[model samples]
Target chain A: EAGVTQFPSHSVIEKGQTVTLRCDPISGHDNLYWYRRVMGKEIKFLLHFVKESKQDESGMPNNRFLAERTGGTYSTLKVQPAELEDSGVYFCASSQAGVGNSPLHFGNGTRLTVT
Target chain B: AQSVTQLDSQVPVFEEAPVELRCNYSSSVSVYLFWYVQYPNQGLQLLLKYLSGSTLVESINGFEAEFNKSQTSFHLRKPSVHISDTAEYFCVLGADKLIFGTGTRLQVFP
Candidate 1:
């Protein structure tokens, strides 16, 4: 079975530019999550999506960041007016809902560099 | 608040040597612990997990972790690590939404 897939494995953008990272979850998985890891730091959770609706978004850093899951399939995270601090590896993960101990399947992640 | 902490930033060891990666988490009423490893250019994969019954859990790749509730720790250990074991290992908490620690990079040399 194919695992979670992320687009544009690497992305570089100017400080004020906007960037979007995409993630395609595993087939039939309803729980999609977004996490980011800054250099030398722990991976921090951003938000979680149960199908098309967002279940939690308390970890979002700011309002400039937006996340959307269309048709409950693929997810996209957008950062507008990207700041220098936004540079990091954005990882996307998916898991099946209702399973007690189901492990998450993650993507290779997209390394974003804001200059 | 929930959090995971991996004190060792990096550990260098020779092949066939025993290695331990320390991890500690904030004391909670109930917790699910996991160790996830990421090899070069690869995504993070579950190495092992400790849920309810057994405090000890083992992975197929000769790695094991014991959940110590009294100490609030879950340290990963490998009796004899292989060179291919070089990677970053993350200590994670939570069942659905995971809270990860600052991974420990284990570099196994020949």
Candidate 2:
């Protein structure tokens, strides 16, 4: 089976510009997650989706960041008025739903550089 | 609240040598421990996990991790590592949500 794939492996945008990162999860996976790492910090969870439904979004940093999963397929994370602090790697992961022990499969990630 | 700590930021070792990467976590509830390896420009790959029963977990790549509740650690070890084993290893804990450590970069020299 194909793994999770992401688009635009690297993106460069100005501080106030808008950018959208896409994540194509593995086929038949119901659980999708988004995480980000800034500078040299650890990867932090942003949100999760289960079949196009928002499971949890408590990790979202602010309202400027919006995420959506349409048709229970690919997911998109859009950042408006991107800040310099948003420059980092954004990783997308997915796994089988209702299975706590199931491991997550991640995409190569999109490296966003906001100047 | 939970957090992970990778004590070593980088570890350099000669090929075929044994190595250990220490990891510690703080959580009020029981957690599932995991070890993931990330090659340069690649996504994170699951190496092993300790979900319950048998405090020791082994990976197909000869990597193993022991979950110690007393120490609140899940340290990964490899008895004999090759150059191919070089990668950044992250120790993570998963509960209602997943939490990860900063990661430790392992470099194997020939």
Candidate 3:
């Protein structure tokens, strides 16, 4: 089976611009998650989606960032008015079951660079 | 809340030598532990996981991690590592969400 797929493997944009990253989970997977790793930092959670509803979004950094999982098949993360600090690798993962029940399959990630 | 700590940011060892990567976690309740590896130019992959039962878990490629409740640790070990073992390994704690350590880069020289 194909693993999770992330679009635009690399993106470069200026500060104050807007950027959107997309993720397509494995088929039949209901749990989708977003995680980001800043340079030299740990990968941190961004949000989670169970089907079309968001299960947890507490990790979202600020109002400028928005995530939507329409129909629950895929997810998109948008960072508006991007800041220089927003440069990082955005990874998407999916699991067949909830947190502990299943292992997450991650994508290669979208490397975003904001200047 | 929970957190994961990978004691080593990097480990260098010669091929066919033994190696250990330490991971310590902090949580109030029982936790599930996982080790994920990212090979060069590849996405993250599950190396092994420990949910219950045996405290020791082994991956197909000879990597093993032992979960120690007393020490609050899940350190990975391999008696004979190959050059192909080079990669970044992340120790993760599974709570309501997955909390990851900063990651340790394993560099195996021939």
Top candidate on DockQ is 3
Off by over 4 Å in 1: A98-100
Give all TM-scores, in the order shown. 0.97, 0.98, 0.99
Stretches of candidate 2 above 4 Å error? none
Native-to-model Cα distance after best TM-score fit, residue B61 in candidate 1, in Å? 0.5
The better candidate by DockQ, 1 or 2, is 2
Error of 2 at A73 (Å): 0.9
Best by TM-score: 3
- For residue B108, what is the lDDT in candidate 1? 96
Candidate 1 lands at a TM-score of 0.97
lDDT of 1 by residue, B23-106 (tens): 999945587889999999999998988888989999999999999988999999999999999999999998447899999999
* Model 3 C-alpha lDDT versus the unseen true structure: 0.96
Worst 10 residues of 3 chain A by lDDT: A67-76
lDDT of 1 by residue, A1-115 (tens): 9999999899999999999999999999999999999988999999999999999998999999999999999999999989999999999999897224577899999999999
Q: Which tens-of-lDDT digit does each residue in A1-115 have in candidate 2?
A: 8999999899999999999999999999999999998978899999999999999999999999999999999999999989999999999999996335588998999999999
lDDT tens readout by residue for model 2, B1-110: 79999999999999999999999999999889899899987999989999899999999999999999999999999999999999999999898778999999999999
* Per-residue lDDT over A1-110 for candidate 3, one digit per residue giving the tens place of the 0 to 100 score: 99999998999999999999999999999999999999999999999999989999998999999999998898999999899999999999999998889889999999
DockQ of 3: 0.93
DockQ of 1: 0.69
